[model samples]
Target: MSTATSSSDLIGLVLGTLRTERASTARFTLSAPWSLRSDGVEGLLIRVSLGEPYWIEADGAEPVLIQPGDIVLLPQGAPHIVRSARELAPLPFSGLLAQHMSGAHGDHPITFRHGGEGGHGAALTELFSLHLWMPQHRGQSLLSWLPPLIVLRAAEVATTRTLALATQALVDETLTQVPGWQLVTARMADLLLVHVLRAHLQSGAAQAQGWLAGIGDKAIGKALAQMHANPELPWSVASLSRVSHQSRSVFSERFVQRMGTTPMRYLADVRMGIASQQFEQGQADVARVAQDVGYASEKAFSRAFERWAGQTPSQYLKLRTNGAQIRRHKG
Candidate 1:
């Protein structure tokens, strides 16, 4: 396969693993002199500006101006402030929700209207917010490799007309609340995420370093695809280099340079990631999961899992089980 196609396929595989579970969607309409602070959140947070321009300041980052048609993603759900001006005193986001939301759960998007009366020449802003829960095992790695704030500018959205159309559709679906609107909005939000990542990759931001840079590299991407596609395989530097059509030494050096880890180490991490997912999903048979991930014996797998995850298999399972029970109790 051509290098571009290989890279694209590798990206597809990586993105495919990032499945999102819908949590909540909110539509906010604010007049000028309004600001809200989110004290970090779990899972991914997405915000799309549909009306007047606004400013967002993520923790430890400079403020960013978000214009109409602009999409902002907090992949790690960092604490942030959205305001009409950077100097404005921000109110807690939870306060707004408590004041406006009626505590009714349904398919309809939660609506919040805050700010001064609209009589004066106040700037009115409308934005849609979405929260999604990503897979526990894979999401942390993927999100860690990404910048905290990913902004797809309005100009870029205009150029990629599909993104603009999808955003509009999401907004309309959330507002109208037609039959099956929940599912439609969720799917659209997911699609927008894909487009945003693609745009970010194409913008050369992925060329610097990290997993994205590894996927963008022609030779390294091929090896990564092979590993991800079959983590159970007994992969080595020599074998992976052969697949990449490069000498063993050259491929190994390039992979390490791009991915910041040795080829074998990356493969081990991939295997462990799959095994962790299995465990998180209630797989009680440790031996089965070990064998499935190419561990010759349960003891060896346990040692490696402990090294990679900082916890033994049983300990990890017990922790996960306890966490689930607590969530159930709260529910």
Candidate 2:
């Protein structure tokens, strides 16, 4: 996180960090099928089958047939479409009445279609999008080891029955649009995500590598946890080497190969990422955050912040809080 020149790299790092934090200030909602086309998706798409089976088509990858209890991951974020059991008809974003937005804006909208005989049946379709602000990882890493797409299916377990029923209640709550029901929707989205993540972990796939792989490794997991727990420790490669019981050079190489980042860069990122979280939560004072991140002077912190965040600390905070507010309003 010491330096990131690309937005995609920053997004990959931010997505990695947010995938685990329980505070989960992020949100999820049931978008009208084309609503995803209007809303910014740039991330992941999750859909629950309503009745009929559907499939996906993408380049440099095989078209996946999705069934009940199966989840698919489109790793490369290619153009994807979900069609009925009978045909491979495409559902492009243009069909949703949105213009040039396809290429003029940021990430194209990722669409999640709830298709099945159920037809939004008793359960409302849910789409969760998580975006976090953090500096990007710098180096070759495991982020590329994962498949281009991933899916988790839950139809087989008896526990899923309860999930379906609860989702039905969510459907009712959203349709009625009761006071504070958005909170209910947000909560349900969080819960549903936990359920989906659980299935992914249970599958023991390589893609679960980000969180599970990092946290599960005896050496690297311990190191990542330590970095996260005490980001302001002014950590150095030798310090981490002592903790991981490896030589300094060995530790640096292993961390880079395993985590896709150098130790100092990761430490800088964790500290600044923590600061970013505080800013998002409305902790407005940049000077105080600079202290918390262990910068003795505001000037150094500001330079680092501008380099990592592409804005001054104050500007970054304002953008986060105000930008988040704007998104909430648009929703």
Candidate 3:
């Protein structure tokens, strides 16, 4: 396969697994001198700018100015501050919600207004906040590889305009609260996420390091595509290098440089990741899974899984099963 097609296929496979379990959307209207702080969250936090410009300060990162039409993603759930100015003292986001919202449940979006009255020509800011909860086992690895803060500028998003349209649709559906708006908004959010990630990946910002960078590299991407496409294959450095059309030494070095792991280690991770997904999806036969992931014996597969996951296969299954039971019980 061509390099571009290979990379796209790998990306599609990985992204397809990021299914959100629950999602909530809200609109925030604030006047000048207002700030809100999030002490991080369990899943992803997305903020879309709709009105005046604002500032975002994520922990361990420099403050970023967000203009209207821009989107900011906290993929790693880092503690962050959103404010009219960088130095504003932020009210805790939880406290703000408690003070302004009550029994906020259901599919419709909630709108809350805060801060000083619109006097003295204070700037008013409008923002759409999206919180998505994804399965931890499926999302944790991908989220860990992404930067804590990702800002997709409006100028860049204008090239495709799909993201812009999706955001607009989300805002409209939520505000109108028409019948079936809930489903419409949810689907729109999913589309918005895919577009945001595609834009980020294509912007070269994600090329700095990690698995994302590896997928963006022409040579490395080919090898990664092969591995993801057929994890059951007994792939060696030489085989993968040939698939990538590079010398084994060069391929190995570049893989480590971009992915921070050797080829075999990355393959192991890919296999384990696939195995975890299968287990989550109700595959319980240990030996079958072992062979499916290329291991010759259940004992060898169990050993490798334990080393990678810090738990035996049965133990992992037990945890997942218990967790599902708890969720069902709560429901």
On TM-score, the candidate that comes out on top is 3
Model 2 weakest lDDT span, ten residues long: 20-29
**Candidate 3 all-Cα RMSD:** 3.5
Per-model TM-score versus the true fold: 0.80, 0.66, 0.83
TM-score of predicted structure 3? 0.83
- Please provide, for model 2 over 1-331, each residue's C-alpha lDDT reduced to its tens digit, 9 standing for 90 to 100: 3321222223334343434211111112322332222222343333444433455554435656666435444432335554443243444554442442233222233232332334434334343232211222231122233454666655554466466546544544444445555455445554555555445545565343354444444565556656665566667778778777778888777777766557777677667667766776678887888888878888998898777767787787676677667655755
The lDDT per prediction is 0.75, 0.50, 0.77
Task: For candidate 3, write residues 1-331 as lDDT tens digits.
Answer: 3434555567776655555555667788889879989888877877776668999989857989998878888876789888998888989988767665545443346788888787767789988777776545433356667788989898776743446546655775667766655556556666666767777878888957777788888899888887777878889999999988999999999999988778898788778877877888899999999999889999999999988788899999999899878755754
Which ranges in model 1 have alpha carbons more than 4 Å from their true place?
1-5, 98-109, 137-140, 157-161, 168-187, 247-250, 279-284, 306-331
Per-prediction RMSD in angstroms? 3.9, 8.4, 3.5
Better of 2 and 3 by TM-score: 3
Model 3 CA deviation exceeding 4 Å by range:
1-4, 98-111, 119-122, 137-140, 159-162, 171-190
Predicted candidate 2, C-alpha RMSD: 8.4
Q: Which ten residues in a row have the lowest lDDT in candidate 3?
A: 99-108
- Backbone clash pairs in model 3 (N, Cα, C under 3 Å; residues 3+ apart or in different chains), count: 0
